[model samples]
Target: QGKNKKVIILCSVLAVVVLAVVAYMIFKPEEKLAVSTVEVTKQTINETLDTTGTVSTASEQSFTLMNKVKVKTVNVKEGDVVKAGDVLATFDVSSLETALNEKENNYEKALAAYNKAKNSSSSASGKISSTKKQIAELEKEIETLKAKTSTTKPSSTKSDSGVKVSDDLVKRFIKIAKRFGVEYDEATARRVLTSILSAGSSTSDISGLLDNLGTIAGGSGSFDMSAFAQMSGGSSALINAEMSLVQLKAQLATLELQSNDTYLSVYKTVYENAQSEYQKALTQTNEMKKGWIASEKGLVSEVNIKVGETVETQTVVDGKDVDISSIISSISSGIDVSKMISSFFGSDKVGIKVLNYPLVADISLSKYDVLDVSVNQEVSVKSANNEIHEGRVSYVGAVATSTGSSLDLNSIMSGGGSSSTIPAQVTIEDGDKSFIVGTDVDISIITDTQENALVVPVEAIIIDGSDVYVYAYNKDKSTAVKKKVTLGISNDTYYQVLSGVSEGDVLIKNTSGLEDGAKVKLK
Candidate 1:
C-alpha cells in the first residue's frame, strides 16, 4: 500500500508540473516586437520634378541640284570649300548652243521684218502728206476758175436783128446767164467769186454756194428778155464750168479718201509688225541671258553629277529649279557644300532624332505643383546606361495628354496614342556626343529647396488625402502616439516637416498595420 501511495504522489506532482507548464505556455504575454524607428531630424530637402528627354546637335545641312542635263564636268567634291563665282560643275552646252543659235536666227528675221514695216509706214506717211497737198491745190484752182466764170459779163454788139452778141460775148453771156436766178447772176455771183478769191469761204461753205448757184441757174425765173436770152446762152457755158469743178472736187475727195485709207492700213500694219518683232527680239535676248547656258558666279560645295551622267530636273528649292550654270560655277569655286545643300533642300539645320524613353512613373500633379515648374531648371537625367546627367527643363506643355481608353494598337501604330501626363521637354546639359537626339532619359527637376529644414523619413509620414499623420514613439518605446503634421517639400526618401513633429521625436518608420489609436510595445 505505501509503495502504491508514493507512486500516486509522484504522478500527482508530474500532473501539477505539466499543468503549470501548459498554463505558462498559454497565458504568457507576447514578447514585444522590436520595431525600427527614426528620430525627427533637421536637414535640407529638395523637391524635384522628374522626367526624361534627349540630346541633339545644334547644326546640320543638306543639298539638292536642279539641272537634269547630262553632266559634262564636276569641278568639286563633297565637303569642298568654295567661294563666290566658283564653278561647281558643267553640263554639255551643245543643246543650249543650238537653241541659242536658232533664237539668234529668229531674232534676225524678226528685226528685218520690223525694219521693213517701219520703212513702209514712213513712206506711206509721206505719200499721205503729198496727196493731201495736191488735193488742196486742185481745190484752190477750181475755186479760181469758178470765180472768173461768175463775174465776167459778155460784150454784145447791136445789129439789125436785135443785139448781135459775139461768140466771146455769147460765151461770157452764157456763163453769166447760167448764174441767173441760181447764182444771183451779176450781184451775188460777183460777191461769191470775190469771197472764193479772198479765201473768205470755208471749203464746205464754198461747195454749198456752188450747189446753190447750179440750182438757181437750172430753175425758171423772170428777167429782161434780151438779157435773159443772153443769160440763157451763158447759162450752159457756166453750167459746164461748174460741172467740171464739181467733177474735179469729187475726184480730189475720192483721192483724199483713198490716200487716207491706204495710209492708215500701211501705218497700222507696219507699226504692229515692228512692235511684234522688237518684242520677240527682246524676249530672245533675255532668254539667252537667263537660260541654262548663261554663266553664273557662286560658291558650290557639292556636285552630284559626274561626266556624262544623266540626271532628272531636280527641284532645288520649293518652287525654283536649280540654276545649272550657277551651280556649276559655284562648284568650281570652293564653297561650303553643306550650306548649299541646306539651301537646296529647305530642311532645318538641326535634325531631330526621336528616342523612345518609356514612361516610368507618371502621375497627375496638382495645379500648385505645375506653377512651380519652369524652363531651364537644373535637373537630373537618368539615361539607359544607368548614368546620371545634368539637364534643364526645356518646356512644359500647357495642355494635358488625354487618356481614358484601353491600349489601342491602331493608335499606337499610327502614333496617335494618348496619355494622361503633360508633355514636357528636357534637354540634357551634361553628356558627351554619346547622347543622341530624341533619346529617352529620366529627369528630376528641382522644384523647391530648403536648408536646415525639419525633416523625417518618408516612411514615417502617413498620407491620407490632404491630411498627413505620423506615429510618434515615446522615449520609453511603450506606445506610438498618432500625431497630425503639416509637411513641406519632399524628396525621394525624406519629407520636410512644416509643423507638428520636432527634432528628438522618435517616429515609427513603418506604419503598415498601425491604426490611429493603436497600443504598442517596444522591444
Candidate 2:
C-alpha cells in the first residue's frame, strides 16, 4: 500500500514540472539571431576567358662565315643599330684581286682580239684578199706582155687576144668587182679583168661574170664587144702587141692605187675595233666593283671577321675548260631554311640573348577559343607577382598547335581527350623591361558582358547537391524562406541570376547555419 502511494506521488510531480516548462516557453519566444541581408538588384556582370602565356622575343638574327674563310675587316660592334646593306664584316680579297688583275689584262687582250676578228666580217677580209691578188696579177700581166713583145711580131688591135679588153670582158669585169662591194670604174674594170686572167680566174667566176654583165647590157647570150671599144680608151693600138702592153701598164696603175688605199683602210678599221673593245671591258670592270650591297634595314649587332686573313680558292682556267666554284657568299647565305623562324619552322635562336621592354607574350588558346580572338583585341595580363598589364592582341594564328607543356582547363577537373591549341601574340603597354622573356603569366580575355542583370551577392547563392538556392525574407519579416535561382555569369563579387529569382526579393547575404525553409531574422 505504501509503495503504490510513492509511485503515484512521483508521477504527479513529473506532470507539474512538464507543465511549468511548457508555460515558460509559451510565454517567452527564442530571440531571432541577428544576421545581415541584401536586397536583389540589377547590376552588370563580365564573362571572361582566362589563360596564360610566356614572354618571348619578337625577332632575331645570326652571322657566320661561308667556309674556311679569312676575315678582312670587322665593321660593326655589338649593340649597334645598322641599316640594311651596312657592312658588318669583310673577307681578305687582295690575293684574289691581284690574281684577277693579272688575268684581266690577258682577258681584255683576248676579248679585243675576238671582237676584232668578229667585227671584220668575212666579206671585208675577202674583199681585201681579192684586191691583193688582183694587184699581183696586174703586175705579172705587164711582165708577160713585155716578154711576148720582145719575142713575137707586132700586130694590130684586132690581132691582140691574150688580154681581154673588149666590150664583153669589160662588162664582165665591172660586174665581178662591183658584186663584191669594191668601188670600180671602166679603167678599174679593165685593169681587174686583165689581172684576173693573169692570176687564172676560175671558169665558174668567168661564166657568172658574163651572165650578170649580159643582164646589165640588156642582152642574155653575151655582151657586145665592139660597142664598148675604148668608151674611156686612152690610146688606139699602133700594133696589137703594143695595144696589149699599153693596156697592161694602165691596169697595173689602178690596182696599185687600190692596194695602197682600200686595203690599208680595212686594216686600220680592224685595229681601231680591237682598241675599242678593250676600252669597253675596262669600263665595265670599273662599274662592277662599286663594293658590297645591303639586303635589309636593321641594327648591326655582330661583326665576325678582321683584316689580313688568307683563304684558299679554286682558279678558273678557260683554256683547260675547268668549272671552278665561287668563293664569295651571298647575303641569303645568312638567311635561309636553316636560320629561318615562323609557324612553318618552329623558332630561331635569338642573336641577342636578352630582350625586354614593350614585352610580347606568346599565348596559346584552344582552337575554339582562338576563333573569337582577333588582331588588336584588348587584353589584361596578370603576372606571377600579381602585376596587371594592359595590352592589345597582336596576332591570332589560323592553324592549331601540337601537344605541349600547358595544362588544359578540362584536365584540371575531369579527364579529357588529346587537345590542340592556336597561338596568339599580345603586346603589353609600358612593359619597360620589367617582364622577362620565356616566363609564364596569367591572362584574361573579356569575351562577354551582361548589363542590368538581376544579381545577388555570390555568398547568397547556396548549392544543395545539383540545385542552387537563395534564402529570402518572408512577407511578415519574421522568418527566411528558400528561393531557388538559375545563374548566368559571375564576376569576383556577384552572381548574375538568370531565373528563379526576382530583382526585388530580399536575400540573405550571410548564410551561416542557414538551410532551405529555415527560420531567420534580418539584422
Q: Can you give the TM-score per candidate against the true fold?
A: 0.38, 0.42
Candidate 1 deviant stretches above 4 angstroms: 11-15, 22-29, 57-370, 394-424, 464-467, 475-479, 514-523
Off by over 4 Å in 2: 1-18, 31-34, 57-357, 404-417
For residues 366-417, write the lDDT of model 2, one tens digit per residue. Answer: 7568766888777888765688889878888888876655677644445655
| lDDT of candidate model 2 versus the reference | 0.54
Residues 1-523, model 1: lDDT tens digits? 9999999999999999999999999999755435578888888788986544444433232222223334566556543444334444555543544433433454454445445545644565566556656656655765675566568863222121332223433344346445443233454444333323232223444345344433323322122213222222233334334434443443333333333433233333333433443344354334323422212222222344566766554222321232322432344367653355345533211111112221122223333456888777777766667787776666677886665574534446657645344555655555443444446556677988899999999888898998898998765646668999998888889999989988888888878777654556654
- State each model's C-alpha RMSD to the native: 24.0, 20.7
Please state the error at residue 217 of candidate 1 in Å.
67
Clashing pairs in 2: 72-306, 72-307, 82-298, 82-299, 82-300, 84-296, 84-297, 85-294, 155-240
TM-score of 1: 0.38
